[model samples]
Target: MLVKAFDKNIRQNKTTTINTNFVVIGGGTAGVCAAITAARQGTKTVLIQDRPVLGGNASSEVRLWILGATSHMGNNNRWSREGGVMDEILVENLYRNKEGNAVIFDTVLLEKVLEEENITLLLNTSVYDVKKSSDTKIESVQAFNSQNSTEYVIKSPIFCDASGDGIVAFKAGASFRMGAETKEEFGEQFAPDKSYGELLGHSMYFYSKNTNKPVKYVAPKYALKDITAIPRYKAIGKGDKGCRFWWFEYGGRHDTIHETEEIKYELWKVIYGVWDYIKNSGEFEDVDNMTLEWVGTVPGKRESRRFEGLYMMTQQDIIEQRQFDDAIAFGGWAIDLHPADGVYSELSGCTQWHSKGIYDIPYRSFVSKDIDNLFLAGRIISATHVAFGSTRVMATTGFCAQAVGMAASICVDKNLKPADLLEKGEIKNLQNELNKLGQSIPNVPINKSSNLINEATINASSILNLNQIPYNGDWFSLSISAAQMLPFKANQNYKFKVLVKAEETTTLQVDLRTSIKSKNYAPEVILETQNFNLEKGEQYIEISFSNPVPNNQYGFVTFLSNKHASLKTSNNRYTGVLSVFNGVNKAVSNNGKQTPPDNIGVDTFEFWTPHRRPDGQNIAMDISPAIEAFNADNIGNGFVRPYGTTNAWVANLNDKNPSLKIEWDSEKELSEIKLFLDPDYDHPLESTLMGHPEEVAPFCVRNYTITDLQGTILAKKEGNYQTINTWKFDSKIKTKGIIIEAEHPSVNVPASIFEIICS
Candidate 1:
C-alpha cells in the first residue's frame, strides 16, 4: 500500500463557471420542487441551497411539519390536497417514511432532486452577488461554497428567487416590500389600520422522548428566568413537539433577514427555558423518564422581503374568492396572522379567518413586474401581508414553485421573457402543459388539443349507477341532520331525490329555503314544500319546484320533523358544499329531546340521499345520461371530489370487464398518455399532526391495461399507488382509437377515473 502525502501549506481559491437553462436560488421546498419540475421537463437546471440539508424548515434543523391546504387539521377547508410536485413529495413521504421521521424526510427531498438527471444541486452554497444584463434582467449569479472553498458563477436564461427572503431578487434590483400594508392600500379589510414594518416571526421547535430513566437538565445562563412571562405555556405538554409549538416565535419587530442571528438567540432562550420548566419545574409529573431528544438550532422564518410582480394579491381577493383568469395555483388555509410581538405579546397567539372554500393564486403573482427574467416562489412571492398569510405555507409555495419552473421551461423553449409569456397570450399554452403534467387549476378544463376523448366518440361498457345502493340502515332526523347550502339561481326549476324513512303511517312535509342574508347562516324564507304520506322503511321521494332566489344567496332544504319519520344520508359528501346548522342552538327532535347533529358544520357536504332518475321513471338500474360515467366533461373537469358525485367517471361494480373506448375521427400520432385517478382526499393524509403511516390510498387504480384500435396491447400496469400515472411508448404510434380496461381495488367497489389525456 502506497500512502500519499499532501502539502499542508498549499492555499488555493477555485472558481467554477456553469451554464444552464434555469437557475434556482434557495433549496427549500419551493426551490427543490422548482428545480425538479424544470429538470423533468428536459431543461438543464441548477439548485442552490444555503443550508447543507434539503427541505429548509421541514428539515431536522427546524423540524417544522409541512402543512398547507389541510391547515393542520383545523377542520375548515375541505378537498384541499396540494397537487404537482408537492403531491409527489407528500405521497412519497407517506409511502417511504410512515413513521414521519424528519431525518428520513430530509433524505426523501434530497433523493428527488438528485434523481433528476438535468438538475445540478449545490448544497451549502450561498448566492451573494448577481450580474445583470441591464437594470431589467438577470444575467448570472455568483455563489460561494464555504465547505470546498470554491466560487461558482452560474449563468442561466431565467432565474427563480425562492430564497424565502427574496435575496436574488433584492440583489438584482427587483421591486419588493418588507412590511404590512395599511387598510386603504389594497382595500384589504384584514390589513392593519396603521402601517408597520413587522413580519411574521421565526420559531424553533424541540422533540422529547421517554427513556425509562430519569434525565436531568441544567438551565443555561441565558435561559429565560420566568416561564410565567409567557401566557401560552399551557400549550406545553408531555407529548408536544414540532408543529405543536408553532407559537414559539419571536423577532417580528426586527429585520427577519439581516437580524436572523438575534432572532435565533432569542428563540433559543425561550426553547431552553420552556424545556427547563418541563424538566426542573414541579408542574409536570411524568417527566421522570422523559428527556429532550432534539432541539432546533435554526429558527424557521414565516415572512420576510416579498418581491413585486405583475399583480399583488390582496386580502379582498381571498375573502371574495375572486376567480382569476390566469390562476396557476390555489390556497385554502385561513388568513392566519400572529402577533407582531410573538411570544412576548400579551395578546392571543394568532387570529385565523376562513373563506367559504379555496381561492385562486394567479400566475402574474409569480413573475416580477420589472425584472424581465426573474421569477418568484415561496413566501417571497408578490402578495400583500394579509394575502401572504395564507399563501406562505410550504405546500402552497411548492405549487407556486412548480408553476414557475414549468413557465421557465416554456420561456426557454419559446425564447421569450417571463413577462412576454403573459403579454403574448401564451399563458394558455403553459397552463395546458401544466394540466398534462397533473397540475390541477380549478375551473380550468383539460387541454382540449391533446385529449383524444374531446375529438373521439367515447363510450363505456357500463355506467356507474349510484342509485342502485339502497338508502337503509342509517336515518338522521331532519332537525338534527346537517344539510349543505348550495347556490341556486332564481326561477330555474330543478329536481332532486331524497330518501325518507317512516316508522309509522304519517305525513312528511319538506320545504326549500334560503338564508335571510349572505352574512347569516340561519334560514329565514321557505320557498316551497311537498307533502308525502310514508308508511315504513326507506322510500325514495322526488321533489321538483322553481322559485325566485335573492342575489348572493345560499339555498338549503329543510324538513318539518315528524315524530315517526327521518331523512336518510349518504356515507360520503361532495366538496364546496357547506353544512348548514345553528351555531347558537342545539338541534331538537320531535320528542323535544336534544340530539347532536349527525354531521357537524365542520365536515359535511351533500347530506340528501339522492340519485339520478332513469328512463323518465324513478328506477335505480337505468342510469341517466346526464350523470353517466362516460360523459366527456366528467373526465375533463379539473376538479376531483369524493366519490358519489358527477365530477368523477365511475364504472359499475358488476361490470366484470368494463372499459372506456375512445374512437378518433382519424389516425393520429400518439406518444404519451396521462391518467388522474381518485386518491380518496376525504381520507385524512395525516393520522395525527405528524403524518400518516400509509402513503397511498386504497381507492387508487390497482391494475389497468391499454390497447390500440387493432386490439394490440400497448401497456399494462399492476398495483399502482400513484394518483397520476404517465405512460410513454417506445415510439409515436398512429392509432384511430384506444381502449382502457381498469379493475377496482376491491371487487364490490366501482372504479373511478378523474381525467385522462393523450399527447
Candidate 2:
C-alpha cells in the first residue's frame, strides 16, 4: 500500500556560511588523509565530499583495490608499505575487516573522519563555484548539498584540491594541463613521440556470486552484441569478481569529466555483455549457479586535468631513482601506461617499466606555482603523464595528501603561502614534524636532539650473536654460483660465515668486495678472497678481517663459479642483504627447460640467502648492542622495507622474558612513551584479497607491559593491532629507569622493535 500526505507548507532555500583554517575538497583517499591530518593538528577543517560515501574509486560504487609501493605484490617489492596515514588505514582494515568486505571497509573510512573533532564533514556536497580574492589566489568555495538542497559558502585561508579532477583549481583559473606531454618536452623516454589530447579512460567493475539454485541473466536492449568483438573476452574466467575487470574501460578519446554520463552508459553495455558471455558462452564448467550480485554505476576514472606546480615530475626522475632534498613521499610502482583507446585497443592491457628500487617524491610537486594558496594531491598532482602512471595509485596519493595537510597546517601557523614555505627553507621543519608524526620520508631520520632516548643508557635482554639465521637442512647447489652483500655501520668489527654443502670433495673459492660508491647497491671493490677444501654434507666456515670496516661500506661475499658445491641459504632474506645469482640472468621455463631470453632480468630472489647460522635463528645481517633501536636514528633511517634488516632492534633468544630496559643517569619526568613495531610488510593490505590468518602479525608484540625500575606498573596493553602504540600517563611520573616486557605470540620469531621514544 502507498500512503500519501497532503500538506500546505512553504519551504525557503537556505544559505550557510562556514569559516575554517583549511578547506579540503573531495573525500577520496587523498582528501580523507588531508582533512584528517589537518583536523588532528588542531586546524579548523571542512571536508566536502561529492558522494554520500568516501574513498572515491576505492568506494563500493567503484571497487578498485588500493595499491602503491607494494604494487599488488609484484616487481619484488617485499617491504614496500606506504607509511603514515595510509599505514594506519591498512593496518586497521587488516585487523578489523580481514574478510575484505567492501561495505564494512566504507564504515572504516567514515569512522575515521567522524572521529576528528576539528573536522566538519559535509557529505553529498559538490563544490561548483570558487570565489577568488584575486586572479592569483582563491578566497572561498561555494558548495551545494544535494541531499538537503542547502547552499554553503566555505571560507578558508588555504585549500587543497584532491578532487581527482582538480575542480577547484580549474575553477580558480589555475595553470594546468590535460592529456600527455610530448617526449621532447620533458625528455621522457617513455612518453609517446607525438602528443595527444586523449587521456587514460574510465572503468567499471562488477561482483558475481554463486547461489544454491540456478540463476539467469537477461541481456539488456543496449547490451553489446557479438562479444567476439572484444579480443580479451577469453581472458574472463568463471571465478573472477570485482576489480578483475580493470580492462573493461572506455571513453578515453572523449572528455572524461564532461562526458562521464556517456562513458557510464557504454561501460554498462560492456559489463552486461561480458556477463552474458560468461554465463551463456558454455565454455565455463560448473557455473550454473553464478549470478551477478553487484555492478558499479559510477566509472573509476584514471587520468584527467593535472595542476601545474613548482616542479613537474618526469619519468627520468622515477627511473633514475632521483633523491630530492625536498622529498616528502615515495613511490615504487611500475610505470604502467594504458593506451588511449583503452578496451578497444588490440594490444595488451598496458605497458609497464620498472625501476631498480623506489623513487622519492618532492614537496614542490604538490604546491602550485600559479595559485599561491592552492595545494594539489591525488592523481591531479604535478607530474608528466609518464610519471603519473606510477604515482596515481591510492596509497601514493594518500601520502601526497598527508604532506599537503601538514604543509597547510604550517602555513596556517606561519601566515605563509605554499610557495612561501618552500622559499623560506621551512621544508626541513615540515620533514622533521612529519617524522615526529610517524610519516616515513626516504633516507631522512627523525630529528634526534630532543629525543630522551638519546640521553638514556639503553640495554636489551640479548643481542644477536649470529651473522645470519641458521640453515640446518640440506641445500643443493644451483646450476650457477651466487653472491650476497651485507651492510654494516662504519668502524665495526665484523666476521663473515657461510655453510657449505658439498656433494663430493671440492674446493670452494670466495671473494669479498666493498661498495664502489655511496648510495649504490651494487659492489665494485674486492676486499678479500679465499679458497677452502670442503668434505661432503655440511661445514661451517668463518672468515674474520684484521682491520675494522671503513665508513659507509657494504661487505660483498661472492661464491666464484662453484659447480660442485652450493652454499646453504636461510628461508628468508634479511635487511641489508642482497643475493645475486652468479651476477647474470637465468633463462628457464615452467617445464625446467632453458628458454630463450624474455628480456626480463631475474637477478635475485627475496627468500634466498647465502649466509647461515648454526643456532637456527631467522637472523639477518644483524649488528647490535641492541641499544641502536632506542636511538633517534631508528625513527627515519628509511629502512622500513621489511627485508632490509638494518633499522630494527631484535631481542636475543636466550632470555625467557625478553625486555628492553632504559636507565637514565638522573631522574626524568616522563608523560608518554611511543613504540613502533614491525607489522610484517610482506603481507599486502587489501580488502579485495584474502589476508593473512592473524589480523596482527604474530611477530608483533601481542601482549606487553611497561613498568618502572621499582616494579610499579606504568601501562599494559594486549592484542594490539596498530604499528605505532602510544601510552600517555594520567600525570607525569619521575623515574630513573623503565622496563618493557613484550611477549611474542609465536615461538618461531623473537620480538622486534623499530623505534622507541620517551616524552
Please give the CA lDDT of all the candidate structures: 0.73, 0.74
- List candidate 1 segments past 4 Å from native: 1-12, 73-77, 193-197, 468-481, 484-633, 636-645, 681-689
Per-candidate total of colliding backbone pairs: 0, 3
Q: Please provide, for model 2 over 1-759, each residue's C-alpha lDDT reduced to its tens digit, 9 standing for 90 to 100.
A: 997577588654589999899999999899999998888788999999999899998888788878787654444343567877778888888888877777777888999999999999999999998999998899999999978989999999999999989999999988888888876788775675333224788999889899999998788989887887787878888888788678888877888889989999998998898889888888888788999999999899998898899999999888777899999988877777777777777866666665545788999999888888999999999999889989998988987789899999999999999998778999998987776666767777766764677778777776544444546434647455556655555666566666777888888877666544444333445667778888987787776654444654445566766677876765443323345443221111111112222432212222112221221123222233211222323433434333333466666555578788888899999988888787765455765443446577555777889899999999898988788888888999899988988875455456667777788
| Per-prediction TM-score to the true structure, in the order listed | 0.83, 0.84
**Residue-wise lDDT of candidate 1 within 395-475, one digit each (tens)?**
778877898999999999999998888789988888877767667776675667657667777777777643333332256
Q: List the residue pairs that clash in candidate 2.
A: 575-643, 575-644, 575-645
TM-score result, candidate 2: 0.84
How many backbone clashes are present in model 2? 3
